[model samples]
Target: MAEKIFMKGCEAVAETAVRAGCRFFAGYPITPQNDVPEYFARRMPEVNGVFIQGESEVASSNMAYGAAAAGVRSMTSSSSCGISLKSEAISWMAGANLPVVIANFQRGGPGIGTIQPAQQDYLQATHASGNGGFRMLVLSPMNLQEAVDMTWQAFELADKYSKPVMLLMDGFTGTMMEPVELPEPLSEEEVAAIRASKTWAARGKHGGPQHKVMCGPGLDTRISQEQMNERDAELYESWKTTEVEYEDYMTGDAEIVLTAYGITGRIAKSAVKLLRAEGIRAGLIRPKKVYPFPDAAYEKLPLEKLRGIVSAEMSIPAQFAEDVERVVHGRTRIVTALSSGGEVLDRAAILDAARSLMK
Candidate 1:
């Protein structure tokens, strides 16, 4: 078995990014996610990588953008409001088709609501991450191990698609500690080869044509922009078929199903076991990747046999429920167990919602 090391969630993500060959990290300090930059500060130097604590979230995000443009595996992290500050740069990275990994250690929202964990940014992450209609592969890990694994994979996926990828976790998950077997660090030669592969990056001329890194279709005319949008749309659609990931736990004979992601989904797994002990036939469908949401999980469900599908999340007004409703299409009743402003979703609330559906 691989040896495991106990590590905090944020620090694990930072270390994993370094192992994945990320040579540039630029981020501003924010609650919950500050540990990410802190770890990178100490570790990046040892790895001969660059770590910049930019003056602000906006500056840090754009700095990562610049690094990624030069073919470096780059990353940035922030909390909810800080993420908002980085949105414009994120969109630019998307528009430019740069591969950059982003980590959002989500916290209570609307406007610096609190420094506590919350899934209030689901809509922002999946729907309107930026001004553009571009989409990102959003990975939501249920635990620190998954967080480390996903952070490593985020860089690969970002490079694979030439687009930004997001690791979306709440402050609860970011602050938690767990034992994880991290992936091996990339060798210096391997990192060099990866950078060499990015011929499109603006890395100066190497006895060839100079590369130009343009952002957002390069001020193209309306017709040209439309063409670019269509091409980007196809790329986004491809992710649904190739990147959708979720866990279907005890869902085979379930009458009550709980749907969630990230930390809330982790808790919901326990709720499923409790509900099963009580003979409720409860199960869980936890999306590992929320953007190209595991819609097929819902599509494959025996909707008629299910009494209710509970959308459990740490958000007010139940943002995740919107995706559930969209996928289920009213074929079965949908409910929610929600808490916001730093409050977490408890098993009792999920149980109450599922039991009410039984009534």
Candidate 2:
């Protein structure tokens, strides 16, 4: 068995990315997520990897893009505002079908709202990560372990689909410390295999002149662009069939179901346990893959027995609830348990919402 290691969220995630064969990282300093790049700054050299604290988020994003464009495993990390700054480059990478992993330790928002944790970026991360009509595989982790595991998965998924993948974590999850068993590092042969498989990646004249490029409007370019879009559409559709992941807790016979993501989901889980002990038959649905939305989990619920659905989050407008509502489709009453302005969703608040749904 791999020995367990106790580490903070940012360090664990950064180290895990290294073990996953990521050889390049470029990021700007941002609250909560700063530790991620800080760790890489020191450790990346030991692994013969490159780490650059770009002049700004914009520069860091393009640095990552250049590295990945050259067939290297590359990544970047930042908070909400920093991510906003990187959006244009993110879209460019998507259009080029370049695989890169990004980590967003989200903070309260609109425009540099707060440094405290919040899920207000839910819509931005899922609905529109960039200007193009592109989709990213967005994974949200509720705990330190999940964050570490998903960071590793993010790289693999990005390579598999040849597109950018995001790990969406809030400030709390990105700063908390916990015990976790880190995976073994990938061998050089494995890393080489990953790079070798990408025949289309830029490799100078050694691979002969490459003609594949990102979006364009010329006659031949137009035809190829349409083909690429169609292929990307199919890739996105496959995630629904193969990658939608979520956790159902005490939901078998529950009278009310609480839906959330990230730390809010973790809190709702605690509320479910408390309500279960009181015979309220409360349950929780925590989506692991936020972009895919795990709507199928709701379909499997005992809707005939369900009384209500509670959407919990650290956002005032309840960014995560929009999709939950679309899935519930008025089969039951829907209420929100929200904590804004950098506050976390407490179990007591979730408990109160669950009880109110019972009423």
Candidate 3:
């Protein structure tokens, strides 16, 4: 068995990224995620990789963009507001078909609401990460182990799809500590092979004149831009079939279901156990990938026996609920157990919501 190490979530993510063959990391300091870049700064040098603490989030995101365009496995991370600053660069990378990994340790937001953890960024992550209507595969981890695993694999997913892949973590997950068995580091030869596979990279020519051009929206002419968009649309569609992931816990005989992602999802699971003990017959459905949401999970629900689904999240006005509503399609009632402005969701609220639905 691989040895387990107790590590903070953010640091675990950083170490996992390094082991996964990421060679470049650029990011600025932000609460709940400062540990990620700090760990990278120390660890990247040991692996002969590069790490830069840019003057600003925008600069850092662009630095990651440049590295990714040059065929380096690159990454960047930030908190909620910092992610907002980096969105333009994310959009540019998407337009140019550059593969990069990004981590968002979410805090409260619309503006700089608070430094405390919140799931308010769900809509921003899955629907509108940037100016252009582009989508990225958004992975929401419920614990440190999943965070480490997702961070390790995010690079490959980004490269496979030729788009940015986001690790959408709330601040709670970023700062929390747990024992996790990290994945094995990629061998040096394996890393080199992966880098060599990117023939379209902006690296200098091997034996002939270079022909690859990395250009974003305005750089491409109208027809080419349209074609690029069409191609990207197809790639996004493919994820629904190949990448959708979710957890259906005790849902077989459930009369009430709780739906959430990230930290809130973890909490909801606890509420499920309590409800089950109380003979309430409640269950939980947690989406692991929020972008290519596990719509099939919702579709397969025993709607005939279900009383309602409680959309529990640490966001006011219910951001995650929107996706649940779209999938449920009025087949059954849907309610929300929400907290915002950095407030965390509690089991009591979820229990009350479920019990009310039962009533």
TM-score of each: 0.98, 0.96, 0.97
Compared with the true structure, the alpha-carbon lDDT of candidate 1 equals 0.91
- Clash counts per candidate, in order, are 0, 0, 0
Candidate 3 TM-score versus the reference: 0.97
Candidate 2 colliding pairs: none
Worst-scoring 10-residue span by lDDT in model 3: 217-226
Residue lDDT tens for model 3, 124-155:
99999998899999999999999998998798
Residue pairs of candidate 1 with colliding backbone atoms: none
Instruction: Give stretches of model 1 more than 4 Å off.
Output: 220-223
* Model 3 residue pairs with clashes: none
Better of 2 and 3 by TM-score: 3
